[model samples]
Target: MPALVRAGTAQQWPQALAVPGGVARLSLGPAAERPVVHAGDIPVLVLGDAIEWTAIVGIPLAAPVGEAEVTVQAAPTAPARRVAYRVAAKQYREQRLTVAPRTVDLAPEDLARHERERAHQQHVMATFSTPLPEGLQMRQPVPGRRSSSFGLRRVFNGQARNPHSGMDIAAATGTPVAAPLAGRVIDVGDYFFNGGTVWLDHGGGLLSMYCHLSRMDCQVGDVLRTGDAFCRVGATGRVTGPHLHWGVMLNRTMVDPALFLPA
Candidate 1:
């Protein structure tokens, strides 16, 4: 697919919520589709009628079944599809669910300022050109059932918030966090939601993040081998317990980690 096209703000997604994964997909039959991720985000562009794309954001697993809005804007030439989704949160054997306390309070502007962060994330997608590291492999940083459902809506401490940005691996405090792949550390610090976070640049615009670390080992610019000790997982930012929150961004778009691993 081409990487650029006439971009426009899609006014809305009327039926975007009915899909199983809270995602809507559009498959362009047989034409090359151009995609632009705003800053450091990935833009999922489906090309060809047989290639429908899926758009999904996670909702809280504990949330009572409900409805939410999705914003979309595209043209007939670049038409968009809307899908509504039904959600049910499951707990026990494999996973658990609950509310996470906020690490801090955000004023309206402090929260809205993230649009720039989101846009910048998308823009990073346009510059992807690095190769993945050699001899790079990964083991689960923490061992536990998933907690925060990926792409789900979340209400932190009673205030509505953005969808969960990463996958939650519920482990005990100080669970060793390892590098999924070999890469140079580019960013390491506390984020608004990702407390004590670190970003690994596995070539190109591909990156992975480890958050809520109770103990951070490597610093920015450190080159690491796969499975290298990166940090110690914990519920540092806002949480009920110690767990490792792992996030991966491919060309800046957040894709399921399972896609890159054995299920």
Candidate 2:
């Protein structure tokens, strides 16, 4: 996908595009609001409640079938963002998505085997060799090194579980967590597994999540500036350490963080 909303004007709002590609880029003019779809004609889905200035959109692509008109709009978001997207689904059609969730608990030897398989999954995610979203700025939501690597085959004691969904950055208890980009804070909760959490809506189909927080600073519908504090890092939920489990949902699929960050 193209990046930075065309790179003109003073400010930009996040443009959402739901087409093919892991990262969708748009150049909405600085302070530009209600940007329209610019990708000529194609097939894409614009999610609601996600369009705003200076946002990141996570897109999921359906296997393209011949010709289709891609529609983009904003209304309600299941963390939706939409604008424009690049056309690449025509050539990349083999989507044998491997979903091995371990299915059950296992003995130590079996767990080791699972870990090996899980490592292979991570290799697959990194196999695409795609570049990061152009014009993206990598600012830490909270200062810390990585506590958990992406796609680590996590075993609780001796039982294997699903690979880690998001990247975990090590931080201290009560460390303030900020919005990495501008967006509306839409969801906040203390779920059974995520501990304290806050979901930020970047305009046009991109949504970000910060989990295992000690506190939530913004309520739903609260607009936040990039780097604005939304919560604090904590060891809540199911955790082996205190860290921020930061995740970006591009059209619902959880891609790698390195897909957006500088290499």
Candidate 3:
């Protein structure tokens, strides 16, 4: 297959939902070449060819519920233009959970370790590689009940924390976790918060993450086809039970993973 799939229509993979923690698919008009688009400072994924191009931008959950824009440069020498879009507000329900006190209130050494791991993971999320020919639509990485939804305001042990950023699937510890889309393994590590994490680069600033695995079967630089098993669900991270935490990221922003899945 070709490295880049030509997006010949306005309707592309990943349904567009322009709310915070959602996606905005903007048309870049017909260009002789693919236009370069950036949501704020980070580059976004631009698909299509010389005919019609579209910019798929991932809006942060913390984004203001109002106007937003992306910079579009039609060509190398062309002047950049701002394409505006609206980001509607979204209200996510609050979730209260009780976990180990140590996990919530980390020790000094654990805090430092988490900080280092967070930095490395941020770098991994910024990866942008060649576009995938297999396209952007994805399959669920694991088979189970949806135990948690994205963007939930989580209160851990009565202490407020960041909103949940991924979808959690309730599954057995040894149940296999597969690749949602064709991708190259970009990062894998056992961390303080996410333990047994794996990040996959789907190219063009699009990536997917799987966390809390009992086992990781792939390493960095390993390429996997859609549906290929790469890990197993587990309760390796800070959690009350075994599950698969799956996240989809675009342009360095973590978006709702359900946007890439079909109903």
Which candidate has the top score in lDDT?
3
**Ranking according to TM-score, highest score first:** 3, 1, 2
Candidate 3, overall lDDT? 0.88
Per-residue lDDT of candidate 2, residues 23-54 (tens digit): 44443333223323422332222222334433
Cand. 1 TM to true fold: 0.56
TM-score of each: 0.56, 0.54, 0.95
- Any runs in candidate 1 off by more than 4 Å, and if so which? 1-129, 133-138
lDDT tens digits by residue: candidate 1, 1-263? 22111221232321222222232233222333332212113333222222432232323223455443333334435544333334434331222234533344656775665455546444433444445333223456567798775666665556656556568898888888878777778767765556677778776455678888888888877988877888898777666677888876643455444333433
Model 1 Cα RMSD, 1 decimal: 10.1
CA-only RMSD, every prediction: 10.1, 11.7, 4.5
lDDT of 1: 0.53
In model 2, the runs with Cα more than 4 Å from the true position are 1-136
Whole-model lDDT, candidate 2?
0.54
Ranking by lDDT: 3, 2, 1
Return the clash pairs for model 3, or none. Answer: none
